[model samples]
Target: MSEQVFLLPDLGEGLTEAEIVEWRVAVGDTVTVDQSVVEVETAKAVVDVPCPYAGRVVALHGAAGEVRPVGQPLITVAPLDAASSPAGGEPAGHAVYREEERAGSGNVLIGYGTGHGGAGRRRRRPRLAGVDDSTRTAPLPAPTGAGATSAATDPPAVAPSSPGPAALSSPGPAAPARAGDGAALVISPIVRRLAREHGVDLATLAGTGPGGVIRRADVEAALGTAPAPDTARGLSAVPDPSPDNGTALPGAQPQDPTGGDVIVPLTGIRKAIADKLSRSRREIPEVTIWVDVDATGLLETRAAINAARPDQPVGLLALLARICLSGLRRFPQLNARVDTEGQRIVQSAGVHLGIAAQTDRGLVVPVLRDAQRLTTTELAAELAATTAAARAGTLAPARLTGGTFTLNNYGVFGVDGSTPIINHPEAALLGVGRIVDKPWVVDGQLAVRKVTQLSLTFDHRVCDGGVAGGFLRHVADCVEQPALLIATV
Candidate 1:
């Protein structure tokens, strides 16, 4: 028997690695082509890998919840001998069955390629149907046709039989003999994890996944109980007063007397984020500069613009991006990075601004390449696409690379200001804070005016405080007088 090795494919995003969320097969088990053998979760989405060979499983390289790099072998299969081919079966080494070929074949494996001659693709296996010979043991009842008798009134066509040891030990339902054979329960990894953590029985929870597979929300809903009080409180509510304070209850137990609490292992995007951030900090020499801008005029200008085009309104970040691009033109030094290894300064011809967006997978910076050439509307569109992709974890590797500078908008989170970190290889970064209405003396009389804070952090090696200040002042001017951007652009 020849063995075939299956390696993880590049999941369309050019990601170098993925986490093995779950495995549907084990060693010593027989599997057919196109069967879902494993489910892997990349930064942006979860995908199921189908087996490429039909044979008994020989080895598994990784366990569930383990992180594996791309191109690594995920599973191995040993092909059956050509002489042992079932009646009418294609000769051994003949191309494995494909879905298109299953149309004519009567015997088909569930979740695998169709039978001998174009059989319909195997149906997904139901969860409760025991793994071994489930199809044979619990085939779906025959449909009632005009001439057909109901299963209830007629003698059963099939009888229940003892499943082999391998089938009984399998994790999911056994493959069926034909399409529409039986209902298979599908569940997501997140839903499964939630169920396990909450001690909810998988059998009791109805799947909401594709074709009525169980989903995370469905599992949570079925549990009917909220996460532990501590978990919920930690996520949203403010901390309670210390016990030493007068507000302390007399008999309240102290929080987790143990110094250490639960520890969740880092994997997937979170792991990628930690690694990148550490590399940036260690390699880049950062220097931050703050400018308290008189944003009154800028705020008024933005309001007027929004009022004029209510449907296609521009955000403060859009205005900030224009300013940053304009400043880059004025202080070209800020647009250049030090190439120490090359022994030269590498200055980019155009500005590609990286917008730092926070997602469930931590921070991802998607680049708006050539920001200087884009109009406000175009910039907004790009921002929307990048952010949506970031949140979805589907950003291409190129989109996350090649940033000449970065802009972080903390204003949306209600933060007044922050000294943002420079993405390594980028010379500078700009932070925008929330706009507030404050008292200001305009033309001698005190009046309420809008104000905001701008923080710029740069590489001192390439840009001095004077240049940094000048770039910031230009940004302020463009924001304060919105039309200035037209001339600068």
Candidate 2:
């Protein structure tokens, strides 16, 4: 049988090496063309590399967590037809192997390919059309009052009945009530932990989050202005309100603080993020520029649009995306990347905007392909899909890569401004801050207006300060006068 060697391909974004995360096929296992052979974690993302050859796996080069360079032999496959060669064809076999080696030399494994050369170009996928744009305006879950008694008093009909000793003691629906319905809150894990440590009841807090889902802000609001408990004065002791049913057993003793502590190993998404961010900081040189924008016009336009289409959930980010896309056309330099190997700048014809989403695992940037071509409603639908997939950890490898630019909204976190790190390989990244009422001079008169801060971080190697400033100004112009976006488009 003839043996064929499989080499690792460059996975693009200038990644030189990857750590093998898992091997789907073992020695003696059969693999087909385009079938995943192994999963590799790169500095940017986790991707499954498909076997280019169809044959039985003869050997694996290395185990998981071993970093291997690009274009190196990763595995060997013995083709089924190798035994049929004539005795005298040994010389011819060597020649064929050499030819195959040469052919695979320049081929990249996945998203990285020389088809576009040093340009780093990709074909834009068409946006999924005809989706309801109205859903973009869907209200986020609002904060609800914490505590069972508070919720029971507010919505008596929906509250669950107090289970008896037999029901409460059982490990079923009773667990939720015993936990004070805190589990029902849609807040993040960190928020939940904070609430528990501070003895805050999620049910008693009024939710300001979308869809009446209680958020961290709601919990803080509920605990507002309360005097700090003095632990030394014995004012810090709080009673546990868990139901005391006859069938329920006593709780376990608290562990010693000085005893052995838990050591949680970073794996999955967290590990992936650390590797990527470290690589980006080491490889890419980032420069940032901040601009203050008057968002009064944008706010008014959004309100009017929402009023006209009450069913759609239009968000501030969606509007900002539209403005950014419009600005990218005038300043296409911001829509490109610098190719250090070629010593030239490569411009992308299409706009794929990546939005940074914080999930339970880590930060994920899912691309909204062809953001420039999509309508406001279409963009909103795509953004929702990307974010939902990210939070669910179902985003495909392709969706996580090939971003022309990125947008990070720190406003949701209540931060007014921040200098965001640029997603490597992309020319620029935009950071949007919280909107607030601020005094501004409009037409020479001072007035209180809704305002926000926009910060742009770019690769100085490709774009100069002048170009970056121009791009920021362009985006600010569109956001301040959103009507101009429709007119220009």
Q: Choose the strongest candidate by lDDT.
A: 1
Give a tens-digit lDDT track for model 2, residues 435-484: 89999999999999999999999888777899889989989988898878
lDDT of 2 at 62: 71
- Which candidate leads the pack in TM-score? 1
1-489 in candidate 1: lDDT tens per residue?
Answer: 578898876665557787775556556555666666676666544566667677766787876566778778889898866665655453322223222211111111223333453325542222322133443432222332211211223222222221223333443433433223343243233444334434445454444444344555565575555333233212222222221111111122223224445344566666666776787688778888776666876667667877998887766667777788888988989998889898788889999999887654457788889888998767766776667555445555557778899988776666788976677878898888877887878789998878788888998889678999899888877766778877977
Model 2 ranges off by over 4 Å:
1-267
Candidate 1, residue 334: the lDDT equals: 92
lDDT of each prediction vs. the true structure? 0.60, 0.59
Q: lDDT score of model 2?
A: 0.59
